[model samples]
Every structure is written in C-alpha cells, then in structure tokens.
Target: MFGWVSGFFTYETTKSVVVKSWSVGIINRVAQLLIIIYFVGWVFIHEKAYQVRDTGIESAVMTKVKGFGFLNDNLMDVADYVMPTQGASVFCIITAMVITANQTQSKCHEMDQKFKCKNDSDCESLTFSNLASGKITGKCIAEAQRCEILGWCPAENDIPIEHSMTEVEGFTIFIKNSIRFPLFNVTRGNIGENLKTLSCTYDPVNNPDCPIFRVSDILMYAGEDFSNISKKGGEIGINIAWVCNLDEHVDNCKPTYKFTRMDSAFKNSVVTKGYNFRFAKYFKSEDGNDYRTLHKAYAIRFDILVSGNAGKFHLIPTVINVVAACTSVGLATVLCDIILLNFLKGAKQYKAKKFEEVSDSVSRSQSLDLHECSQKTIKREEKSSDDSGAYSIGHQV
Candidate 1:
C-alpha cells in the first residue's frame, strides 16, 4: 500500500536536450522560421484572421430599359416591348409576338396540325388533348380536319411571324442596386454618389461607376450573339459583386459587374425551346359582348443577382488568432525532435539525452545496504582497539 501510494504521487517533468551541432541547430532554426513565416504571411495577413466577416447581405434592385424599334410596320417603344413596365429587377424585353386578333367566345377548330384527323374516332385516340384553342368538343369537324374546340372562334395559329426586334441591340439598361451588411451597419449602392450615372454609359475601363449597360455589350460579355437570342428569347444574368474590406476607405468598396448567359444549356432544346408567355387584351364590342386579342410574346429576360461579403476589424478575432499563432510555433520542437531521433547521424546520443528515468526501488535497496556496512565496520574497529590495549598492559606487568 505504501509502495502504491509513493508510485501514484511521483512527479514527472520535461527533459531539455541542447544539441550543439551545425546540422541539428540549422534544422531546428529553419523549421521554426518556416513556421513563423507561414502563420504571419498566410494565416494572419493574407487570410485576414484578425477580422470578422458577414456574408448575409440584404439587397434591393431596380432596373429600367430605354429604346425604340420598328417591328411589323409598327413603332414600338419601351411601353410596348418591356413586360411589366414598372422597372422591376427581373423584366423581359419582347422581341417577337404572335398576335391572334378578334377572338370571340365560340366553337373553333384546333390550329395544331397534330390534332388533324379524318374522323371523330381518329381523334378519340388522343384521350387528354388540351393543346387546342380550348376544351375539346369530342368531334372532328369535316370542314376542318382538326379536332373541334368549344371556345374562342378562329383558333390562333401556333406559327410565330419572322419579326425580330434587332434594334434591341442598341438599347441601354440602367440598374440601381443597394446592399447592406447588418453586422457592420454599412449600406452601399452600385451607382455613383454624385448622381452622374444617368448621363454615363458603363465601360469597364472608362466609366465603371456608371450603372448603365448596352444590350449588345452585355451579350458580348456573356459570349452570346444578340441576333440569335433576340429571335427565340433567352435568359441573361447581370451579377453584381460587392467584396468589401471594411478596414479600407468606404469609397473603395464599390460594386463590380459581371455578365452571364443563364439559358445557354437549353438553347437548342426541342421540347422547351425558349422563354415565352401569353397574355390577352380585352375589348367590349358594340353589341355588349366581350372579345379579346391574345398575344404570345417571345422575349429576352434579364435577372439581376447580388452577392457580397464584408469584413472588418474585431478584437475577439484578433486576440484568438494571435494566441493561436503563438501556440502553433511550439510545433517546431516536435518536428526537430522527430528528425534528430530518427534520421540524424548521432541519433542514439540525441535520443538518450532527451530521455531520463529514475526508479525508487533500486535507490531504496542500495541505500539500505550502505547503511548496514558502515555499522559493522564501526563495531570491528572498537573490538580491535580493546584487544591491543589489553596485550600492552600484560607485557608491561
């Protein structure tokens, strides 16, 4: 029990071994220097370990388009071509339209050629045929070989007229975007602060602060042909990036612009070709009946996307990273110990010096034997002195 208690209370400490060779010293110092450089140059300065970052950005965007074009013998303005003319961020510029005029509520034949059949029984093979002008009447009229429908007389032709609003290439777009970082309480906009954005067109090298962009230039930046996209209508993206280092001047945190073709993958799709939607304009006839003109508009859509990260100096991050850097420097000792113990020429000597052991059992046994030997030697000396004094007295008598 005593031995167990003594063993349990034993103290252990680290052994320091100073190696005084050129190779080992050089290796140790070089390892420490490299560790210091890595933390200072990469972890602290380049990565900005001393700052706190916010990526949750709140943003608002508004856009406007301005241009005029002559299409199908009609003068078209922004009010005519721009869908949802309220200047929203995501808007479409119509390039082509299939107009079906004077559609009244009556029975009509489907315009789709796939619905054409010889008899009513032939159209019966298509059970769920809703692609007609309206609800199917379940009869194939002999006059028209297509299936009969019960609404909108004189069915709309699915064929679009070959009218491309090529003049849209010259149109200009103005974008106003505002972004905020809630953590830092900073708000910024893409347009110039002096309000000169209205008169200037955007050029990467000349007028980067302007929010205006030309249609052709946007397509050029996205590597798309304006004429091809205007014919069938496709989606384009306008990306605004606001990467800010809040430690610097606020003026230096202006937004950067990028263009992308969003619908490039489905450009050649046969089933879902391009971007189009249908809407109708109603009119009241003199006979008190309602009639309408349906328009299927093919348009180029633009989506404005905003993204950003803002970083600023903070005391918590600075202190935490500084402590981490200091703690990380101690790794050099481990690296040097590994090289010295396993790979160096005098590895045995270094390994021996770096480790030491003290056993209590061996020390206790040696001390007990030494104490017993001194006691016996003292007894023998006293006995010899007594004998010598007795023999001298007898000889003198």
Candidate 2:
C-alpha cells in the first residue's frame, strides 16, 4: 500500500544533457542555423507570413472610347461607331453592319436566298433568336422558292458588305478604375492627377502609367491581329490586378494591366466565329404605316475585369509566426541527438549519459527492504520465544 501510494505521488522531471565536444556542438549549431534561415528567409520574409491578407475587395470601373473613321465616303465619329453610347465598363465598337432599310410589317420571303422549296411542308417556323428574321407562314412563294414569313417586309438580306472601320485601330480607350480594400479601409485608383491623360497613351516601357490605351496596342498585347479581328468582331478581356503591401508607401501600390482574347477558343470556328448583334430604328410613313430600318452590327466587345488583394502587417500574425519560428528551432536538437546516439564514434558513452536511467538500482533497493523486514520478523520471533517459550511451526526437529 505504501509503495502504491508512493508511485502515485511520483513526479518525473526532464534531465538536461549538454555535450562539451566541438564536433557535436558544431552539428547542433549548424542544424539550428539552417532552421533559422528557413524560417526567416523563406517563411517570414519571402512568404510574408507576418502579414494579414485581405482578398475581399470592392471595385468600380468606367470606360470611354473615341475615334473617327471614313466608310462609304462618309465620315463618322464616336456616336456612329460606339454602341450603347453610355461609356460603360462593357461596351462594343461596331466595325461592319448589314443594313435593310424601309422595312414594313408584312409577309415576305425567307432570308436565305439559297433556300429553295416548292411547298410549305419543307419550311419550319424560325421564331428562335438569330433564326427568326420574321414569322414563317410555312407557305413557299410561287415566284421564288423562298418560304413566306410575316414580320418585317422585304426581309433583311444579311449579306456582308465589306465596310472597313480600320481607323478604329487608332482609337483611344480611357479607363477609370477605383478599388477599395474593406478590411484595410484603403482605396486606390488607376489614374493620377499629375499625368497628362490627353496626350499620353499606354505602352509597357515608355508610358505605363497613362490611363489612355490604344486599340491596336491592346490587340497586340492579346496576341491578336488587328486587321483580322477588325473584319469580324471579337471579345477582349482587360484584367486589372492590384496587389498591395501596406508596409510600403501607398503610391507604390499600382495596378498592372493584362489583355486577353476572350473568344480565342471560338476565333477559328467556322460558324459562330465572332460577336454580332441586331437593332432597329423605327419610323412612321405619311399613311401611318409603321416602317423601320434593321441593322445587324458586327462589333468588338471589351469586357473590363478587375481583381486584387491587399495585405498589411498585423500584431497577431507577427507574434504567432515569431513564436512558431522559435519553436521550430528546437527540432534541431532531435536531429543532433539522433546523430550523436547512433552515428558518432563515442555513441555508446553518449547514449549512457543521455539516457541515465537505473532500473536495476530500484530493484536492488526493493530487495534490500524485503530482506530487512525478514530480519526484523526473525529477531522478533526469537525474542518472543525467549520470553514466552514459543516455537515456530516450520522449525526442524
């Protein structure tokens, strides 16, 4: 019972062992230096583990386009080429158009001049988008093999007329972007008040900070041919990334622009190759018959995409990473201990000193205690027999 109680109350403490050898000391110090270098150079400095990062950013963008071009011996300006005319982030610049003027609501032949059919059964109702120029009556006109459709009369001949707005290549696009990091409560913009926005145009080396961008340069950056894309419309993506390190001056945190062809995958497609849309201008005749001019415009679409993150030094991250770096250094001891116990010349002696445990000494002490008890019992019985004439049952006769 006493032994069990003593064992229950036992407290085991770590024994510190220090080797005074130069070789083992150098190995231990080198391992610790390597660990310190890894933590300080890679984790703390390069990885910026001491900073708290905020990826949740809010953005607003506005864009404007300006250019002039001559088409069919007629001069046109921004109003004539740009669609929506709102100067929005996503806008279109018209390159070529198919115009069908003076269209009145009446039954007319189907659009495809190559479509020849003698009967209504050969035609189907094309009320779907891109297919539905007009409502098909399912009756083939006897004069031509075209199906009769009731909607816009004198249905638009969607034949491409080679009208090149090549001057659009020299057009200038102005972008204004503002972004805010809600966590850090910091806001930044792409434009600078001191720069000359009027004459400046974007170039990677010579004029990077300019808010104005040329159309051809943007296409060049995207690795697309200006002449080829101008013939047929295409979609382009403009990416503006803002990466900030709050430890530095806010002026150093600027946006980097990237351009990519959004429809590069379908650029080589045979059918759905480019971007186009349709709209109409309505008018009323003297006889009150509603008439309109339909236009199918092929245009290049510019979609501005913004993304970014900001990071700042925080006390919590700094303290936590610092403690982790310190704790990681202790792992060097384990490596050095392994090398000393198993790989060194005096490994046996080092092991003896490192693990100074004595199970045999504990067993010897227990045996000594048992022996003393036996001696006491024997002495007590001897004394009792002398006094009261007692004898033990196991005594030999």
Candidate 3:
C-alpha cells in the first residue's frame, strides 16, 4: 500500500542533476532503462487496467474494449483485438520516453586554447585556402614595412640598425615537437582545477628580422645554438620557408621576414602547462603541409596555468543512444502490460450457457408438437367415415 504512485509519480529533478554529473559512459544506459521501465509499467499495470470497464449502456463507449475476446483469455493470443484501441497510447508513451531521455543528456563541455604571433614575420602569412564551397580565401594580413632607425650609427653606408626592421624576430619555433598535459592521474595534485591563459616571449638571435636580410629565414642563425646531445626534447630542427600566395600565382615577394623559436629563454614556453603560440611560416610545401601540421606534430612548450574549475563530466553520444534504446524497450514493456491485462479480461469469458440450454429445450418441444399434430390428423380421418354421431359425441365429450 505504499502506492503513492497515483499523482505521486513526481519528476525527479535530482535524478536529472545526477545524470548530468554522470560521465558520458553511463548516462545513456540510465536514461534508457528508466524509459523502458516507465512505459511498460504504465501501459500494462496502470493505464491499461483503468481503461477497461462496463458502466451503463449509454456510457458504455469503454465497452468497445469488451469485444477484444472476452478479456478473460490470454492477452498474447487476443492482443489483436485490443491493439487497435491501445495503439495510440503505446506510441505516445514511446515517443515521450525517447524525447525526455535525449533532452536530459545533451550537455557537454570543451576547452580550446589559442596563440598568435606578435607580428607578421613571426607568423605565417599569405595562406591560400580552398574552402568546402570551392571558394578561395586569402589569409595572413599583409602589412606595410617601414625602416626605423634603432640609433644613428657612427659608421655610414651600413644598413640602419633599426629595431630589427622586420620586427619578425622573437618567434619561438618548435621543432621535433611534443606536448604533454597531465592526464588527470598523471598530474595528480600538481594540476589545478581552473583554466587560465599564459603568455611567454622569446627573442630569436641575429634575430631573423635584423637590419640585414638573412637568406635562410627557415634556419635559426642565433648566436646561442641551443641543441642538446641527448635530444630529450624530441627530434629538433629549425625550418624556414617564404610565404607563397598560391591563388595569386606569386612565388615570393620583397623578402622581409621574422624569426622566433621555442627554447629555454622564455618565461613560460612549456605549452602543455597552458602557454603556447599559433604562428605563421613562409613557404608551404609540395607535401601539402603547413604550420598547422607543425602544431599537430609538435606543440609549443609553455608553463601550466590553471585559472578555474573544469567540471569533470562529459556527455557522449553513446549515452543518448542507450537512452533511446531503453525508451523503446520501455514502450515495448508497456505494450506487453496492456496485452497482459487484455489477456486477463479475456480469461474471464462471458458465460452465455443459459441461452444454449433454452435453445435446446425449444428445439425438443417443437419436435413433440409435430408428432402430436400427425396423430390428431389420423384420428380425424378415422372418425370421418362414421361422422354423424361420432363427430357430435366427440364434440359433447
């Protein structure tokens, strides 16, 4: 009698909250099971039972269900009769379950980190891209370069010692790249819960953008060649290429370039920790590879920076599929329940045995009446011959 289910079937907001917190792995299964169960219970035990009954002739529209094989028979065999009446109910419940389950599991979270070079030379410029629509888009905004004097040089005829005329230096190029983030367990307590942006700056030597143009922009001509014998930092090398605008059919322009590389000098170049750079390179290749490839191949190293809490749970598509399956099962269960109730009703068949007995008696009485009529005809014929007194005597008697 703990049947508080009548109007007591409350929506569990708490359940929804729990579901949201639940990882993508189990959410679908939970939702699916709930849907299946709810429908099966409702259709067979609750809704189906309430639907079948006989009140009065005028109010007996509900009696249409009675034609479904006496309601006393097994529902499985007699389900055909009731299916027509209950079909819509079954469909509605199924639909409702699927919709609710999907709605409950649709939230997801993502973290996107981005970096940009300080200037064009430091970045890859003039990228020609063919989009999905077959249209070409030009990238790497072109900026006008001007010669600025760093200081009035005592010696004449020397190129102006401007602050690296192409201020394209200080770029942190990462070669033989590798990126490592604490994979939850790996970081253990070292990792923080929040998200933050970290920035680090490095000045590449003889710096590529110096007053004098360098032939190998791809090569790092810095005074401090930082190469380790162990190569612990992964396969390391510097590459330089000029930006080509494929769509414009231009191979190279007035070559003013910048230089940057990722080494120990920066405050926070450990990329995995959070700080990184998105840079541009000159000269894409026949291999159809670009700076993006480098990013994927190797991530810039930088310090780890955590600013805020990244909630732990992520909802996956599989979870939704599970919930849908569960809902479908639940609907099926409800249909089964409805069929069961119909079966029970069919089992208790309407006993019209009295009508059979009365028909039999009437048939017997009809036969006897026919025999008596034949005998009366015979007597009438026999008395006809001596009709005079006989007929009168018979009448008087």
Among these predictions, the greatest TM-score belongs to: 1
lDDT of 3 by residue, 1-397 (tens): 4567533653322110111112322444565566766655764344332222222111001111111111112221223322233322111000000000111111111111111223444323322322111111222222322111112111012121122111112222221111111222111121122313212212244332322222123224322222221111221122222222222322221112233333434324454221222222234457653311111111112111112111122244335544655558545434433433354333122112111223446879988887878777868877777533211111110
Candidate 2 residues lying further than 4 Å off, grouped into runs, are 1-38, 113-115, 124-130, 326-397
**lDDT ranking from best to worst?**
1, 2, 3
lDDT of 3: 0.26
| Residue-level lDDT for 256 in candidate 1 | 90
Candidate numbers, best TM-score first, in rank order: 1, 2, 3
Best by lDDT: 1
lDDT of each: 0.85, 0.82, 0.26
- By TM-score, the better pick of 1 and 2 is 1
Model 3 lDDT at residue 307: 20
> Which sections of candidate 3 miss by over 4 Å?
1-172, 175-324, 328-397
Q: After superposition, how far is residue 369 of candidate 3 from its true place, in Å?
A: 36
RMSD of 2: 12.4
| lDDT comparison, 1 vs 2, better candidate | 1
Question: What are the per-residue Cα lDDT tens digits for candidate 1 across 1-397?
Answer: 9989988898787765556666666777888898889889998889888989999999999998999997777889999999988898899999888889999999878889888978999777764766767888778988889888888877889895577888999999999999999999999988767764387888888888889999999999999897788778899999999999999998888999999989888989998877888999999999999999998888999999999999899999999988988888788888878877798777777766666667878779888877878877868888777443221111111
Query: Across residues 128-195, which tens digit of lDDT does each residue of candidate 2 receive?
Result: 32564677676788787887888888988877657677888999999999999999899999986668
Who is ahead in TM-score, 1 or 3?
1
Could you tell me which 10 consecutive residues in candidate 2 have the lowest summed lDDT? 388-397
